[model samples]
Target: MLKMELFGESLKQIGCFQFSGVPCSYLAPMINYAINTNSFIMSNNEGDAVAIASGISLANYKKSFGVVLMQNSGLSNALSPLTSLNYTFEIPILGFVSLRGERDDMGNNTDEPQHELLGIITDKLLRTCDIAYDFLDSDFNEAEQQLQVAYDYLAKGKSYFFIVKNNTFEKCALNHDKNIFFEKKINTLQVKDSNSNFLPKRIEVLQHLSYFSKMNEIALFATTGKTGRELYEVEDLDNQLYMVGSMGCVSSLALGVTLQTSKKVIAIDGDSALLMRLGALSTNAYYASLHNKGNFCHILLDNESHDSTGGQFNLSPNVNFAEVAYFCGYEKVFIISSFEELEQALCFFKNRNTGGAILIYVKILKGSKEKLGRPKVTPKQVASRMANFLSKD
Candidate 1:
């Protein structure tokens, strides 16, 4: 049994007495402690936990901290809010992640195949999200210090996490307010009024890219949501990086691979997700400048809406993506509105070596893939395969 008194005291010291997220058997001790002594809220899912935390932070105008307790498998489900809301709005959260079956000293492996991936790739997921976190141990004093550091990061508008292994904390009382109140406020206003026919087609751009490049030579990283689904439906997505979750991060992931691998890494990112983490472009540019790797190409499909979520307007202004790329230190930036222009841009990007990132902005129509199926591989599996692939000659 794990004791939460130390962790609770640390939370109290940081003034982050509020908690959120779903329950996990591994987190029962901490959950029970929180319910017994702190203000905690239980959400429907991990994503909802993040959303509610975001709301609380925005409403209170204080550094709000929420402990999202969920099984490692629920990480994918929580990524949308993690990458989008947290990354975009710079909402800080302290995730109390329960690592259920990660002990090496265990006699028999009770973990499922799904959990294996989660356990292996949890750090990678946090890294891609640009979140810094630490693993929790039984040492109450050390855990308290770590929690304090997490609180400080949260104060600075960055998400931090504390990964807890199974049975790490001692059992405690459950005395939380049953009614964890959250206001239900919805924004129903449409930001854009024009039903413009000027937007281009996603299929046209995909077709052009497929035609221009040899499929084997070009590795595509598709962002989560409609852009990924569309690419999966259009191309032979055998080993292509089809992001299951973690929206607004395909470009960053592409940059990571482009830095290490010799293959051309192309990221098919959506406008909404791109806008969510626009700072990623600057980060990518900084790294590209440092490493001088110029094989990264980010194809931004600007549909001006969150097409995956019922076509809600993302308020993405009609800004020149080329200009944005140039400002971010991209060596070559191309804003294409037609198939021919995209083809020419691709050719130029393939040959350019100015030691920077490239942004190819394609104006696309907003549409959802009604029949797009989920990818077979998990994020952990993909990470493993990619690591192995990079390690090879």
Candidate 2:
């Protein structure tokens, strides 16, 4: 069996870093190794993990593979990116899945009843993804060979999988000495008043972002639903990555991109999406502080409701996202209610020289253009173009 460090070192040899996944007991040892000595993120869900991996791979320019790990039960959650992302863009990922309910000699289920149906279909599901898989077990040479095969597939622009039965890796303990989140000066919001009737619309906000994104060469990652659609309607830029279907992973995707590029990464997020994956905020905060490059922005276009999926309400009215981001280690917090304040905030971001993260809380009204449209390009095209742009800049 491979020790945790050996496994991690082997992965480094293949040019892979930036691990993102949900916590599963079968993955704890390997994850602990990452937590202690490597780049790791505890993502909000399996789908978010996949999107983060996708972001890393898109920014990698065929040089590295990002790893995403999750339990087999979470396969359904990950399917969104597994299909729409890797399959669509030919972006490769070293995905690890925990096979929870593998039956033994007596044929009794090894895990809870909830896993039985999924366990039966796990391999078939991988087959459906057209992804090749190998079991991770007690042989170092054999497992390394399997990884080599996975690398071969990745070189050809495809994802590969590792299935762990139960208890595969040696324990890698988390050392408390490491600072997961670096200390930064506590941030406070400077509020300015605006006319309630003159509050800007969503499309107007997206237009401002689009212009700035192109002007500043900032990589823009928009949340799924109307946010992406509206951004597309405003203008399609090579630097933009539109979230197709992953609802809650906009910031996670932004984090991965921020890690790989010096250009500022801006996530145009929605209230519902943010609420779904609140953990991603802390993940972004921790990594943003560690990878402080003076260029990361998080904009919450909160309409106080799920404006995309009909006027369904979310918790943003009761929850203060600007305050939340401030506590989450964002260096600059801007909670404003008008276009003038937003302009001030963007100017603040443009002029800041050192490490900084900003959250713009604009009290926006709900409405969109009558003829909203999606991005005309494919996800692969979008990713490749962004990769090329990032490489050049």
Candidate 3:
């Protein structure tokens, strides 16, 4: 209850009545409170939340602010916008991340292996981005003051963050509009060309992406999944952007980078990750309508399983992703089930209008790479490199 009161007071004090970001069990109490108060904007991913906040700040113009909440691991997904777009373009964002493995944090035994590094590096990652942040462990007044400091930074064209340990906040009144929380629909589209039934192996898709990489006009970003690992192994590690953590957000990050630079951006993502955060497609459509960045291409590789997590099955119903893209507002949507068709789609996307985004769906087989290597560089390094790359003429 003390934590809830402190969080409420902090939100009111900093003028951050609006909140966004994907849900995490670690921050359930805070998320529940935000929803209860009708101040939460529940976005598709951390990156989408940051982009939305950026848009809100740009449109409102009177020091508008929003809160992005996520697990520490999701920080990798949100770093692109945090560094390249927000830092470079001077868009202020405030993040409230839930720390998963504090000395007294709950659910430590049940946590995933991937979250271990995130638990240790959260603070270091923030500092690397040049963001001034504070850890809210138990002191209510200290948390409030930190929020104020964060607000000040946001007002001055910089991002601020406050990391709270898990379960620090107690349950409060559920005062949010229930209508705002809606279940996302699964979108699966059948390929129009059934004759081209030859799907490419992961190696083949990687080779084709390599061709795109050679062009110098395109930059590739991979999400956290088999697709990302395969791309990492097959592509030049130094030349491409690989998200070691932060599932379901490569597309949004690429969109932010594309918005900032003229170079075409490609995101290699997976079906499970896409299912985890489908709301990003709608956000992409919305942003495309406003900014019209023609250089963003989202390549969704559908394997129908969480291959990185013990090949768990995703029971998403067959829905049309291309139609979903169209509904979300992308002018160019191509769904291909075969390698040849994918190649054709890629060629078509390359020549399409530079005003809207393009989505190309590539269906692939699901399996783990036995000896896939992890990323050597930290998330901050990847972010800084992306910022530097996008800033160059």
Q: Best lDDT goes to which candidate?
A: 2
Q: Which 10 consecutive positions of candidate 2 have the poorest summed lDDT? A: 190-199
Q: lDDT for every model?
A: 0.64, 0.81, 0.67
Cα lDDT of model 3 by residue, 259-302, tens digit:
54566778787787777678898866655544555667788776
- In candidate 2, clashing pairs total 0
**Each prediction's TM-score against the native?**
0.51, 0.91, 0.58
Q: Per-candidate RMSD vs. true structure?
A: 16.0, 2.4, 9.6
Stretches off by above 4 angstroms in model 2 are 112-115, 191-198
Q: Rank the candidates by TM-score, best first.
A: 2, 3, 1
Residue-level lDDT of model 2, residues 186-244, one tens digit each, is 56765434445556788899899899879988889888899888898888888898877
Q: List the pairs of residues colliding in candidate 3.
A: 35-176, 36-175, 36-176, 187-319, 188-319, 188-320, 294-354
**Model 1: per-residue Cα lDDT over 177-238, one tens digit each:** 45433222111211222453446677666666654544435666677876666665676433
Stronger candidate by TM-score (1 vs 3): 3
Give model 2's TM-score versus the native structure: 0.91
TM-score of model 1 relative to the true fold? 0.51
Candidate 3 segments exceeding 4 Å error: 1-47, 51-93, 96-159, 162-196, 237-239
